[model samples]
Target: MNRRHFLMGLAATMATARLSFASTGLIAPINIPLWKGPPPGGGGPEGRVIQSHSGALRNITVPGLSILLPSSPIGHGVLIAAGGGYKQIQDGKEALPAARWLIARGYTAYILHYRLPGEGWHDGNQVALQDAQRALRIIRQREKQVSVLGFSAGGHLLGMAATRPDYRAYTPQDAIDELPASADRTALIYPIITLEKPYTHTSTHRILVGPHATASEEAAWSVQHYVSSQTPPCFIVQAKDDPRSDPHNSLIMYDACQKHGVPVEMHRYPTGGHGFGMGKTGTETVEWPGEYKKWLQQSNAGG
Candidate 1:
């Protein structure tokens, strides 16, 4: 181990500790889904599971709880996706803090308990989009506005949902069918927007597509290509040195948004490795959420 690598590991560990503290009494328990049949054709399972699906047209319950902000029509609501690299939703560090962060800014926040791999409910990516689109529609029906935010694989999922020209995740009922074409804004914190070339998370790619999926199938899901002029205003934050998620992930998305003339703002911090949600540690990365908040205020997006 070299000096720099050792320090980087130490920094990551310290951030994790801060998360354990700042995140205390916040994250509710997650009810992990269990599968009964063969996993998805790839490396996933393929069978039925015993659990109440959030149902076809209602707010699906994941392992966590929702925290509603006290303000009325804060003008924005966010669907929060906690990252587990598409394997498990990290209820503690990722989901709860993110929800609370938005709530503090007077935005209604819904924590998504997306389907996990081998859970026998639905494909992880499909389940995540269904949850997000459902949340957007539910919030919009009541208030007519909302936004979407994600971190890591959750970030990737949101990117996929935002750029998709159609909704094929599930059957369309009035609620699901009537979903708006796009969110008002999207905040991607170290998102995995592209699986095509420069910065793919191989482990995550395998989990999402399974080992057997063709290269084309894997390529089809890459979020970078999904970006068009229709993409909503976006905010991105990244750690340039993050090993798990290459900084190029954010850079590629930024370039795509620019190419299409979509509004975008990105901040690339020199530190703060992967999974360092909400800048838990006293490291410089803690400033990202604050920076986003300022951008929101400037855009009149403040609550």
Candidate 2:
């Protein structure tokens, strides 16, 4: 089947499950916009998210859902985390297209709808990471290896998933903690790693930790300081001109990676403002995905 048709079928199958937002008296059907065009190379978009039995996940709003399977079934997979300065997923700029890009390169890709803001940052924090961990576990249960690729806040959550201990946001009946401890690799596109840094202190940090968070919590969230040899191989790309999230964010991450002797590839481009997911017009950051693809191949993730 063609890409569009396949997506429709997938949606149909998964949509049978309904999400009831009774606590807020809202019931919205999950609608994900599809990209119009030939299956963008290595994979077409066909992904869906079913409601979990877990009650009322906070701030979790999935604007869309889609997955890109590699041309050949390679056991490895990537979970695409769309960034939204802690507000909303920049769906167009970062979500589906990012998955498509990975699929084009021959890796199964899954898009996630974790929690959102106004639902409390702690809830958002816990829910997003739990969703990612669950997604990874679910995919792995099916025998597919999985990693996480996120932009901005999504990137932040991915970092949390990688570094933080696996703690369920809610109590569970199952004895086995299905969450995957480590993704084979983490691809961060201009991620906000260190809220302790001046550039990251004001905005993203506030959104994540709240207006009243103490210095200790911020230090805990700073992925750079949290990095150890245990952190996964990370590939980061940042734009030098991004005043919103400075290049130093990636620089600190790179430095930490080096300090821990973990493999890291950091590319700092001259220009490309923040939130340019999958890269964008007339900037070296536009070449980042291609460069990252090459890096993944060289690093042994492409096989």
Candidate 3:
């Protein structure tokens, strides 16, 4: 099934099993646009906000951010970026579940509705990264203990933010840019870490670097080459049998982190396939969330 249809079905399935944050007295998420006025580079006229049959927002022109506050604050925060190969945003499959899980564990959760490059947004290739960085800066202004979690292409974005905190998609406009883009910890799920041939997801590569991208542009985006000691400690989860994204993507990232003295942990399940955000219940991959929590605690303690 296409992503739109899959997301529609996933939304329907989730409706019946949705947890009520209201019952626990948690505040509903408030949507906040990434920009005060028009997004940088001028997004042209606002495009139609497309939605799936199940009412989930799909194609977007004006990107936004929402914070899901926990019932009891723990002083920690996480920014989540769902993946759709830079063409769409899969919030049902990736964002909501992860945000809910994090909130339930007392961490403030931020969900990013990042712009898609394929939609002809301003600075096409840089729109998503710009939104991601803006979200980080906004959250940092209020919360000091922040981490990032991303799936697939979103993971690529998060990896880039973690490794290259100084890289800017656009020139800074105000004080928000003064805040660091670094995350204290990062979780990458079946990520597309490289933009190199054979391993890179074609559609994502095309959207991010364009069809006529130069060698330097492609090399600059491949996160593996940017890993350094400053790269945040990362927890990577992937399936050896994932058919969409090569498991070696995570391997190379892990190797780079190790080589650069950046603390990292990886879990390669036997056969969970790609895009398993929370993973299937009763499967080995379902334990990833728990593993990630443990890793976070260990990293925090050591630091």
Top lDDT model: 3
lDDT per residue, candidate 3, 72-183, as tens digits?
8777888999887877777777888888888888788988877777765658778788888888888898785889999998998888887888888778878888988778
For model 2, the local distance difference test gives 0.63
- By summed lDDT, the worst window of 10 consecutive residues in model 2 runs over 35-44
**TM-scores for every predicted model:** 0.75, 0.74, 0.87
Model 1 is weakest, by summed lDDT over 10 consecutive residues, at: 50-59
Which is superior by TM-score, 2 or 3? 3
Best by TM-score: 3
Model 2 stretches astray by more than 4 angstroms: 1-65, 120-124, 165-176, 200-202, 299-303
Q: What lDDT does candidate 2 reach at residue 155?
A: 82
The alpha-carbon lDDT assigned to residue 231 of candidate 1 equals 86
lDDT of each: 0.63, 0.63, 0.77
What lDDT tens digits, residue by residue, belong to model 1 across residues 1-303? 233433443344333323433435443322211111121221222222222121111112222224445345466667777676776666566766776677667766766555554443445556556555555555565444567778888898888877873666655555435657467778898888766654444556777776677668777878878888888888998898788888888988999999999889998888888888898486678999888887666545333
